[model samples]
Target: MYFFLSHLSVCDILISTNVTPKTLQVLLTGRHLLSFSSCHTQLYFFGAFTGTECCLLSVMSYDRYLAICDPLHYSFIMKRHLPQFLATLCWLVGFFVSMIIESFVVALDYCGPNVIDHFFCDLTRLLELSCSDTKMTDICVTIIVSIIGIFQVVFVIVTYICIFTSILQISSITGRQKIFSTCSSHLAVVSTYYGTLIALYVAPSSGHFQTLNKVLSLLNTIITPLLNPIIYSLRNKEIRSAFSKNVLRRLKR
Candidate 1:
């Protein structure tokens, strides 16, 4: 669990760091200025991290599944090397998917009016600036999101369903409560992260809430990262204890 949490924490931090500074620059200056190369670069890393988090969240749910549902076999099933392999795979798959989407974005030529309505460079927002046909780009993104995003969300829901079933079987209330608390933090993050994404991407677009969408996008990219460490630490006793020992103790000393 710590292994997954540590990797996730780093990922959220890196994702926010990649996008937020530039976004703040735009917001503060009221300038939508970004170079062609800068736009593509930001678009690449943003998609990469978003895709990575989707996969990582699913993997974390699977880990929780093993720990909760198959406690007797958790140690054997979730071996020392397994977490590393899964985390590495998430990173690879995430970046690879983003590369494909960014490649499509790069191939397009921006004729003029390069001002993006979005604060940060996004593939969808960048598509608006393209002079060429966007049919292919739209198709590619739809495929990637359907495969990586929606599939992962369903996988996590199924894993948690199974986990809940197993939890119900535990005879002790303490046992049930312990397992619930352990998974609740992850569930909270998953709900907030995926909920905003679905609102942004999967929801119907007949009525476009441009300003609201952008605000939600900022939450997904910025506020979520800032909150994750707090969320995990507060819910996780071991992480809280370790933090107090390492951080608070040093301050006092």
Candidate 2:
């Protein structure tokens, strides 16, 4: 699971980096030679990893929900073997889904006005630049995104709602507090991630929202990754204690 997650992270960095913006500018604006195969490769990898990340996040949220809401069966059900199987399945599904969407995207040939307005090679931005009638692409991308992205967000929200409701129902105040602390970090990460994503993509795309969309997109893509580790490490006592112990041992050596 860790390895798959790391792979997704690396892919995200490759696709979302500022280098892509520069490359796109050179290709679209500066009359640089761009091979059709190269563009296809870029779209393939970018979609693959991004789709994988979405599925991985949903899986992670389910894992957290099981751990918090069904603690008694978590160890037995979510063992190392099960996690490995689930992670593999998620990656496979994400890869195929992305391939199908990207295949459709590339099938639409570019005739003129290839200037992409956005920073990265996002499907929507690419569609906007295509000279071909993109009504089909627009509908297709919107449907897929709604199914994959919006579905995952909704699933996480629903699962967490149940988990939090269970936490609140605890009889003892101290038990409730402990449960809240245990789940709070995950909740924070989820809110920050989905909140920004929904604002950027699911909201109405208009000139009025363009600047806001860009700002939220950058926040979700860049800042959220950096903030996730910090939020988890700081709020999680076990992780903090382990880190402190490891540091102390290293210093003593």
Q: Using lDDT as the measure, which candidate wins?
A: 1
Q: Which window of 10 residues has the lowest lDDT sum in candidate 1? A: 202-211
- Residues 31-100 of candidate 2 have per-residue lDDT tens digits of 4544666656766776676677677777877877887788999889988888888778777877798888
**Candidate 1 deviation (Cα RMSD):** 4.0
Candidate that would win on TM-score? 1
Q: After superposition, how far is residue 172 of candidate 1 from its true place, in Å?
A: 2.0
Clashes of each: 0, 0
TM-score of 2: 0.78
- Model 1 lDDT, residue 11, Cα: 89
Global fold similarity of model 1 (TM-score): 0.90
lDDT of each: 0.86, 0.71
Q: In model 1, what are the clashing residue pairs, if there are any?
A: none
Q: Summarize candidate 1's per-residue lDDT along 126-196 as a digit string, tens digits.
A: 78778899998889878877887768988999999999999899899998998899899999999999988
